[model samples]
Target chain A: MMQQERTKVILGVIGADCHAVGNKILEHVITAAGYEVVNLGVLVPQEDFVNAAIETDAKAILVASLYGHGEIDCRGLRGRCEEAGIGDILLYVGGNLVVGKTDFHEVKEKFLEMGYNRVYEPGVLLERVIEDLQQDLQERGLSRD
Target chain B: MELKNKKWTHDQFYAIRGEVLNQWPTGAAVDFAEAVKYHENIPAKKHFAKQLVKAKKNGRTLTQPRAGVALINEHINLLNFLRTEGEADLLPTTIDSYTRQNQYAEAENGIEESKRAGRSLLNGFPAVNHGVAGVRKVIESVNGPLQVRHGTPDARLLGEITLAGGYTAYEGGGISYNIPYAKSVSLEKTIYDWQYCDRLVGIYAEHGIEINREPFGPLTGTLVPPSVSHAVAIIEGILAAEQGVKNITLGYGQCGNLFQDIAAIKALEQLAEEYLNNHGYPDCVLTTVFHQWMGGFPQDEAKAFGVISWGAAAAALAKATKVIVKTPHEALGIPTKEANAQGLKTTRQLINMLADQPFPLSIEVQSEIDIIKAETRCILDKVYELGNGDFAQGTVAAFAAGVLDVPFAPSRYTLNKILPARDNHGAVRLFDIGNLPFTQDIIDFHQAKMNERAKAEGRNASFQMVIDDIYAISKGRLVGRPH
Candidate 1:
């Protein structure tokens, strides 16, 4: 029998952030999408993520946060990922990340500077994220569907 | 050395919170050490402290001193010194030395300690907690190795195990208006927050980590119970990418009839689970509070009955990943540390004692505990899903709709009487019915029992405030409504 296609997705909320709602949602969505998801739930520190990505040879790391202090909370995170040698993985983040409002472009620019593949707002159509992921998978010739 | 490492002389702690805490029936009076080992919530703390002061003033000879909050907060520096320096200092002046420091951590072996020993990070709550931080750090003790640095706590701990010191929403009194997450001051404020979400994600991405959801806010203490829409707004706001994110803590805790909270979370969890599973993600956490307001000690029989009944209900149908059982005395003033200790001790015991016992999740627990939980959830869910956040007016609507029988607001209906008068803003003024402060009687007895237990355990167990009366509820058949 032909093996079922699987994409190892290491998922968790990063930094000092502990929002479990979206983390759970992504788990539900991607598992159904036929990818193998390592559901690392909330309040996760940094090293665990890097270690998991390295251990599983994961294709992606999805981050979620709803607390306002994500800006200060998420400092020095990406460099750790690079140091851990998982720089080629697809990275996705969603949910409210900052405290006290500001501009989205600036937020996007900051994330880009730090090293992120894509970022999403709280209510990004899950379909869009899926579609983008699919395109990335297809380009890599790893698309299951 | 352990004895010598001790910081304070018992007399000082007794004087601070003792007079205020002795008004309850928590069993008997005990000492500071016993209070630390036992008790939970704010009221219990206050009552126990009061009891300790009374015992000392009366010249009661004690066996050993105790460790209480007032003592800990007042003399935090000394404890930290002993805890870090691994040495003891002189008497009297030593206590003064402990009190002199303003922080919880200094330096030891080049490592920094948390300052939570003195106070908490749970900021903004019931007018009383206005200045206090509801969040505190508790070092988690797990059975396995930490996934992070060697000798460090693991990050990939198993299902729903506690964090080294997770930040919990202290919902005693902070208003909904205070949170920066919602009630944005302007569109710019909202956009900036959204951007910040993106940056946080990248931080993790750089580290090959993924955040599912950051549970923020004061939980179920306010109106609107932080709906799915709010969750959606948050997601839409900042998170520009969600390759790995999953759940959010929008599913806050216990308040009024959980009909709405339960149903919404179930729908949201199921919905998100389905959506995320289809998208390739794990089922994330959806918080549901089974607890009600009023932790610590019960001020009166009615308040005690109410909180106890609520706790019993929480034990059965709490669908959340973890549940926090409120102490009986939360409605009163700030619980003495002794009281909080009691509650935590009980919680730990219950964790083990109730482990294998099957909580009738189905209908009929002799006392409609299961029914109330289920019925409340089902009706509330149907309404919320149908209402689509339109008819979402706290627990009032849900109760009127028959989804909930209990009112979330502090009103006369809870006691079967007329409601209170309103202020200019239409908010209820006097919160009376079940609002009684912690009593001295209960505090004293409970402390004594604790002291006795401590003594039996071969520890120095002395102090006037340790009341033994509090444990009555521990093994006492959950009378009046619980199973």
Candidate 2:
């Protein structure tokens, strides 16, 4: 019998966003929960995400942007990923991702429309990402259990 | 930051090491490269040795990002934000100088408006300066080896000023504050108004004390370059002229801190040379603290700990009048009593080590001062830009437009957002000054762990509750605006 593919995720803050306090915390919890994670550090551009995914054959890309300018700075990232031929890679994002004050549902909807498979509002704890990852992996027939 | 001393131990060393290993692994270590040619040395103290050996065998790199992207990039982003938001319509100095350059009426009105906003400046200071009793207790606690001249009459009245320079440094205190003919405002009762200042200068001859004057001197033109920091020095000059007080200390921010600009060094130079000129009383100490605005960038706590300790040591080499070192975990949040105690004791050790090491200032250091002065003056210019015209919500709008050149804003993705990222280059060069005071004697993280152990044993340890309260009470609007 052929061995099944493993669930793996690549995560980082994208575009010109450089905040890392939250990024480090997320990395810690994600690793502890037993998913294989490739953390690309902060200020990753669109191409870096696509390149890392292609290089590592990652199943998803998780983006964190705390500077609040994620809307303007990160709008084209998903499209860039698709162009690099990894359109199927799942995308998850959270943290204080938009500038000024706004509703989180609206933000999630906007990012989802832009092609993210999963979107989290600011202060969405690390475990939520883990649960979503596990569920997604289960559906894909790749859960460790 | 604990206020007392501490020692290092194997278990504590291993504990912080395990945490470090969780991230750097043996194969992912990055930022500590050149400085830590002794990665082997990093793990030597006790438990860390095994981890380091394992990491070395596995080819671990510490995975620290480049400087601008994560470290010094905040400056350029701020600068760009300033440029894009647009320049200030009027220089505060021009208003102070009575130069109605262009749109003179607008300038005149702006000057008037700033004068009205005088109350806004003291956000934490009590509106009424009535807290001299508490201040007197603090003053009494302050001990100095220097004794005053015989027959120096008891001090009757005292005064202190904010010396608000422009930009991030002084902020509107210069031109509007230190007006040459500023009305001689009395202070005996405004302690409630400026309570945060905790400033006290005098007692009104009989019963109560007064801590008067909040003038911000703008020492422009031939006398000296009017950098925001220089404004504080100039104000000190004026304060020294008062005869009532026997001693004074400019309890300024970063007084016990370190920076690329060597700001404390310059402040000391100004104080030493100009104290007598202002006819200030003898024995005013210029103490500094262990603070860094950059620590918030969220690098490894261990590295931050080392940098702050080394920084104060360097500041002392510049011959600090006095110093205060913060505890290692301070950046995590407000320190507990134990943390404060540790911070004090750590600084005491660093100071003791540097005691015999006399500092010699040279033309080279002078050049660094000139560069930093110009750079921050440029920072002031950017701050002025954002003041009037940015259509966006303060800094947020400025960043979206890519008009900001400084990287003060910490985005979630620091790796690409900062260095080689165009606007952040200058900031890297500026902060590089901090790494210059190289030392082999300082055993890096393990040393800190050792000191921490000693501190905990001595009951001087503190655990700071790391505040994750990123939620703005104004619900994320600019402060003072009703949500």
Give TM per candidate.
0.32, 0.32
A1-145 per-residue lDDT for model 2 (tens digits)? 1223445678877654444546655665776677667888666767878888898888888888664445544577778887888777778877655533346688889888888888876555567789998898778766778
lDDT, candidate 1, B362-415, per-residue tens: 322222232223322344354444445422232223323333221122211122
lDDT of each: 0.34, 0.35
Q: Could you give candidate 2's per-residue lDDT for residues B1-483 as a string of tens digits?
A: 110011222353334333422321221222222212321222221111132233334422110000001111221232222222312110010011111111223223333433464311110111002122322222122221111100001111111111110010011221222211111221111111111121222211111221122222211110111233332333332333232322232222232123332544564345434433443334332222112222331223454455455645754565444333344443333223333344445555565677677655566456546553553333233432543421112122222323222222222211112111000111112111111111322224223433443344353211100111111111221111112
> What TM-score should be assigned to candidate 2?
0.32
Would candidate 1 be rated incorrect, acceptable, medium or high by CAPRI criteria?
Answer: incorrect
The CA root-mean-square deviation of candidate 1, after full C-alpha superposition on the true structure, stands at: 26.5
Residue B195 of model 1, lDDT score: 30
What candidate 1 gets wrong by more than 4 Å, as runs, is: A1-4, B1-483
Distance from true position, residue B381, model 2, in Å?
A: 33
Interface C-alpha root-mean-square deviation, candidates in order = 15.9, 16.7
